[model samples]
Target: MPQNIYLEDYTLVQPHSNFVIAGGRVFIKKWTSLSFNCTIVTGNHKPTVGLNQRIIERLHINDIEKDVVIGEDCWVGANVTILSGTMLGRGSVVGACSLLNKSSPPYAVLVGTPAKIVGVKFSLEQILKHESNLYPEHERMSRDELEVLFEKYYKGLKSMGTDYLSPEEKMKSMQYANMQYKI
Candidate 1:
């Protein structure tokens, strides 16, 4: 398929430079929010090419073009820069001013230049508990998967309570009714 920007419902990607500088392809899935001053670049200039040809060569080269894919329920903080070929997993949380050049796992908390996985957004128990009733049975994160992530990025049983889920009704099956869907 041809490369193009594909935005699903409830995804907010702030305007980038007012114009497409590189015309790179981007796909932002649902429930994702990108903050201000963020840049997602899909085009990379070939270093071997001569100065004059570098700019033109990047657009022509088949391998130089790569698309950026942001998964669902991701929150990308302000001043972040995501380079080409980056795929942020679902529920990824990138901190402000981070420079992400590669992909990330689900619920990863990324921060700093050349963003690193600082930690996961929530503890394993909390995440599992939170996702149980919200997402469907099949769509929910499997225990095996969560366990592995727990070993890797898990800290402790943090924020496992539902007190923050005020109004209570919001923790139901995800539908189109409650979302703003746009910035």
Candidate 2:
């Protein structure tokens, strides 16, 4: 993997999954959950004209490479496939057996074969109202507090640069991973 890639701790990428981060840059924000049989592809082989030539034999076979970014507080269900050039916004939820090949809005809930936005987990007003609970009200991080934490984390992910992972992104990622949520 390149130095630009960042994988926050406590990210539950289950077994039998492939995160092809070596081919290109991939920035997975904190507290993201990827279930079993998920595949994140950042590169794809281009079409060749010759019929007889094998993939290995063809020299200079063009390859399209693009960055795959997963925002914070996102949950990718089992058998999900995230293709190259896909940018998932923060606090997004992807249903199981979905194929995500395009960008999504923040707090969107996507499901289906091509992964269309079905609904939002939380309305914009609801999210903003719970923002204050992000800080530790009493150290336990009640349910309301957790929601605030997720929103804060999402903001950090939203601001990640094309270069290195920002401090806010890292802090949000690692912080939520240590919370009460199980992988």
Q: Which candidate wins on lDDT? A: 1
RMSD of candidate 1 to the truth, in angstroms, is: 4.8
Best TM-score among the predictions, by candidate number: 1
lDDT of 1 by residue, 1-183 (tens): 234778887778676522133566888897898988788788776655454665556555433768889998899988898898899988788999998999988888888889988777776666777566446677889979988876766555232223254445554533543563223
What TM-score would every model get versus the actual structure? 0.76, 0.66
lDDT of 1 at 7: 80
What lDDT does the true structure give each of the candidates? Answer: 0.74, 0.70
Listed per model in order, the count of residue pairs whose N, CA or C atoms clash below 3 Å is: 0, 1
Q: Model 2: per-residue lDDT, tens digit, 55-84?
A: 623442566778999987689999999999
Cα deviation at 105, candidate 1, in Å, is: 0.8
